[model samples]
Target: MAAVNRVFAAQLAGLPVFGPDGESIGKVRDLVAGLRLDQQAPRVLGLVVELATRRRVFVPMLRVTSIEPNAVTLATGSVNMRQFHRRPNEVLVLGQLADARAELGGVRVTVADAAMEPTRTRDWVLAKLAVRERSSRLGLGRRRSSLQVVPWTEVSGLSLGDLTEQPQGAGQLLMLFDTMRAVDIAATLRDLPVKRRHEVADAMDDERLADVIEEMPEDDQKDLLGYLAEERAADILEAMNPDDAADLLAELTPADQSRLLELMEPEESEPVRRLLAYSSDTAGGLMTPEPVVLSPDATVAEALARIRNPELPAALATMVFVCRPPQATPTGRYVGCVHFQRLLREPPADLVASAVDTDLPALRPGATLTEVTRYFAAYNLACGPVVDAGDHLIGAVTVDDVLDHLLPEGWRETGLHDVRSADPMKSEEWERA
Candidate 1:
């Protein structure tokens, strides 16, 4: 009898897969599930992996020999992602998993009914795979076949999972619990080897956790989300980026979907609803609710006071947002923003508009970053502001915040490099949620 901490092969889905050198190969993308229904030596005989670089690869059982906290050791010195056949009955590819997602919020998006053209020709064609839908027993296009292709890429496989049977040993029993309970992101994030990280979105109970995972690559996010209960899925969507959240909501059935949106607080739902109303690719669609703002009565000093307040939002500062007193318009209302440094240099009695640096570029809430970037170069502003049709301020986001999209993990949590910026954060400035 081994310790319970050790996961059996059947329980290893969603565990972190590692490399021999102890570096991460990335999580196990998904397990080959259907084939085992007949014989059941193990719940899964193989794992379909989508790599960080956007490539899809396959790993059969038997080749795996040892699993550890950081790596998955394989029996063969050479591992090919595609050597194992992805039988439709035992498929674990991206296209097979996306059909499992549940929609919530008022947002709608179609998962790609496509598959990655495997590019194993290059010893390394690093890529990232995105999963968007679920799969079923029936073949494609049939009423039961909603198989959507998720994306993935490859990394080196470091070690085997659980090290259950040694390189020289065999004899194991397969146990299948719900996939949701079997995988944990925190446990996965800890990079425990032998256990591959599986998509278990439906398994999670915490909206905040789901929200954090939503910011991850789609395949991983979709996997986690698929395991969730419908309402729980909605809760996670409610806590996500509006554009992303809205997109998922649109995928749900009308009934299960609406119930989840209704579960959200009005403020969260409103932005997601607003995002849902826009054309996905248009400036109106991609723009976030974050925009710079100013209070009409706010003197340059007072405005600087807000910027200097460490507690003001990190995402908001990038745009130099100004706050209006009660009952302010949402857009086109600010006279303009003054330079933060200029406040101290100017005379004490200087009028705010006099200090107004109007030189800073401005943007409507509908403006996309692509459109706003030109202004950033033309005017040299750190970022731009967004406004509603009425010209009232909504939220202010900056380029750094925009850069969150580029980060391996987005800015939901401040990272190590954020220290200099985060140092300015003040507890007093945050609006109580």
Candidate 2:
């Protein structure tokens, strides 16, 4: 068999695979490895090859005859061409593990890369991980950075479900997730098995769980809520955006929905209740009740500060509503809105009233989805305020929520949102976890 000392999983992926007769067969798409409790390292199962037909098939390690930088040669020209299917115990090396966070030698580090070593018997095993540690030194009044690689065995918190049982490992896992975006964390959780997904969710706090739940698909959101205790689920719902919370509640039976609503804080439950009053396809159902609102007399600086809230979605932060006294929805009276650009152009000390765009119109709560779509399209608005019969601003509909309603059904299950990179080393931002 042709030999190579070692190669990182990232480098091995995308290399062409060949038959014993030197005929091209396919290219490496990913590597499958079986997790073992008794062994410190995971055993390499095989390579996932994408054929010319765009179909993926499995090539066992035993069938591999030579390992080279450019191509992997199989022992025989004849091979099974069945499509590959993942076993319960197997995980994709490049797909799942390459950029995951791991604890190496008691220090948390990013798994920037991974390597595999060939065994004496001509098989290959996962050998080491290139863990990155970011450190800065003051040299000549300038900062200097360095990166270090660590052995895979030294990594203790790589496994997902293991954290559920190990207190220290759970803490490390939580810390790792603390640095990651909620959307990214949700994507990772969705890839894991149900049991592991529950374990990870159990370890997260209610606020963090709420953030991640908002990013999950409707089915996943319901599954996770169903798994949690009623009280815990209520608390998480309270923490989520009113629009998202209402959407999730709409999926449950009336009895369950009412029970959960009763368990939530009155203030938190009120907005959701009002939203639930509207049909799911209506503008009221798709809008968020907590848009930034200020009296026309409020200063530009105050409006800017409100929009600066990191938790606010980008579209909602683009404009601030100007309302009359009472200042809460149904706002005393809808006046106008000041776009963020107008706020920036005016002096901070200037009154928001001076910047109000009075020409922009608001949508009635009962406006149909098609009407909302036409409103957004005709005005090129990122978001539009929703009002009642008295012209009171109740909430605002964001473009994202509109698109979510308009997209094809079962879009989430089609893998349209799984954007994780298969090769970390080839990523533009490899240094990021």
lDDT per residue (tens digit) for residues 1-83 in model 2: 66677788777766898888898887786787877665377778778776655456667777788888888998843344544
Backbone atom clashes (below 3 Å) for every candidate: 81, 0
Per-residue CA lDDT of candidate 1, range 313-395, in tens? 45445444444454222444555666666767766555555666565555666666566556556766554555566655543
Q: Model 2, residue 37: what's the lDDT?
A: 67
CA RMSD of each candidate after superposition = 17.8, 10.2
lDDT of 2 at 285: 95
The TM-score measured for candidate 1 stands at: 0.44
TM-score per prediction, in order, is 0.44, 0.68
Alpha-carbon runs more than 4 Å astray in model 2: 1-32, 35-41, 45-86, 92-124, 127-169, 415-433
Worst 10 residues of 2 by lDDT: 424-433
